[model samples]
Target: MSIRTNVINLTEFRNARTGPPKRSEPESGLMLGKGLTDQTMIDLIKKFSNPVSERDYRNRALLNLMYLTALRAKEIVSLKFSDLFLAPSGETLISYTKKGGKLAFAVIAEETLFFIREYHSTFEGDHAYFFLSLPRGNQKERSNLSTRGLQLIVNSWNVKTCSNKLIHPHSLRHTAASKLMDLAGSIAVQKLLNHSSPNTSSLFYTKPYFNASKFISWE
Candidate 1:
């Protein structure tokens, strides 16, 4: 069994102690903490999840899938065994329903695909939803996992890794957008993320920092 305890929200605590600001100001267009590196994320996942236990195996798969696919918590919990697809071109497709009530798919990493398979093997219950909670304290067994449960899972990992930072499952989405924006243009990241507006990707998701010295020549 994993550690069961309270998690302190350092950000909220600091904000509360500081009290209200002197004046209201316009919010910044850029979202900070959107650049959690892949290594850091994977490290936290590895640290928290033990492959020997079925629960940790499921958590490992969930965390890996969240990082690799950049899916929302609701979308992740809504997934099912049928969502996995082996394309004729040898690509693995992970399908889920988006918040906007649209069908969406993400091309998952090979490692993540393997984790999903492993999770399924160890997962108890013949539930339709891919993720489920082990029967606990008179709660009826269900096919689907709740969004709140997913939030707690992410929160637990966040607390374990960095008690001061406000990283959660949604942070993975932001990180994915930031990383993809650097590698593939914003349009590509936008499409992958299923954002209707390019402005959302540019203004909210992508980090605005860049080194001018690398691209610009000053003689």
Candidate 2:
């Protein structure tokens, strides 16, 4: 016999405006590494939306999908087409390649899919990996992008945090985590970012549970 469990929609997308700081009552995001303001993140997305070269398409995809989904640089770089799917709900689902290959998933907005498509169109070969290294001089290409290469693209954008630290891949991740935490609370952040303890249930216990990804909605 099959049992049916209720799927809860926990998503709470805040408008892209700064809220008053809760100095007296700290939020879970406060404990996280410093991240960009929501407005700044939106601005960054707009900044990279235009592409002249294939590399530009890759960068635009990185900015939109990575920021929207809160993926770690390593996971984003390690992504292959096999790890992605479009759910019946029409949301983009990604199975992250995290440390030890631990399972995780997050939903991305449909518009971000356009950026992904534009980026993938530039692939020199029909490689399995979604992000790849650019071809140099005469060498044949289509290698998966490394974490360091992801860093270079992020750096080329010259994004920085409040402390002026270059927004390395991790900083961008922090920004994504903060975005989730700010509007959805720590539980939603945990659900989206897979911040479970060894004692807790994996947020994505079953692939079917991907239906719960609505909680992390960017809208």
Candidate 3:
């Protein structure tokens, strides 16, 4: 069965027995899970050429921005040109239009800036959307990449890298959260991630327990 089907079945069974559904808390603690490490990210950059061709350059721009901003796939896919701007200090800011049109800013990295410039140079369509799709034949309508497409891209990269790590597109967000927590603390992470509550941020800081090795460190 499909993963979603399995999940729905499991949820139905659990709810039938429990009377009311129970909400699970977000995982807490440092997790040694699969994600794009610094080296892995470098490898991806090398494997995929910049602009990779005109039609895909904007897609690549979105991918890089999502990784840097730690934005959810849906948020990234739905973003438009008007949502982006340059601040007085020369930092590129992305204004998210979700969650009651909340705004958040992330400083643009030099590498990402280069990709964005390259994408803008090659783009030809009049679409206001930052990312556009090319239609095939006369039947299919062009559209931006969906959330599922984003998931598949990450999964494909994970498989290509041949790491046994279970990396998801969301793992980029996790990595950003971890880095923010380490550099600025949980409160800063909460703000940068645009979490509605501190409790949401706390879950990312929780370390997963694995075997007894973590507790039995030799001093």
Clashing pairs in 1: none
> In candidate 2, what are the lDDT values of residues 101-203, reduced to their tens digit?
7777778677777787778776555778778888898877658899899888888877678556777777776776666554665576666667655112122
Runs of candidate 2 with Cα error greater than 4 angstroms are: 1-33, 197-219
State residue 213's C-alpha deviation in candidate 3, in Å.
Answer: 14
Q: What TM-score would each prediction reach against the true structure? A: 0.72, 0.70, 0.64
* TM-score top scorer: 1
Q: Over all chains combined, what TM-score does candidate 2 have?
A: 0.70
RMSD of each: 13.7, 17.5, 10.6
lDDT per residue (tens digit) for residues 1-219 in model 1: 323322346556777999776775323226555557667866877674668776777778887787677888888888887788977788988778898888888887788867767876874446666688766767756556788888887777654222246667787777777777778866877787898877777776555465779989867
**Backbone-clash count (model 1):** 0
Candidate 1 ranges beyond 4 A from true positions? 1-29, 34-39, 48-50, 123-125, 137-142, 159-164, 212-219
Q: Please, what is the whole-model Cα lDDT of each candidate in the order they appear? A: 0.72, 0.69, 0.66
Candidate 1, lDDT over the whole model: 0.72
Taking the tens digit of each residue's C-alpha lDDT, what string does model 3 give over 29-121? 633353456676666656666456765676567667766778777777676666678888887776665555666656566777677678767
Better of 1 and 2 by lDDT: 1
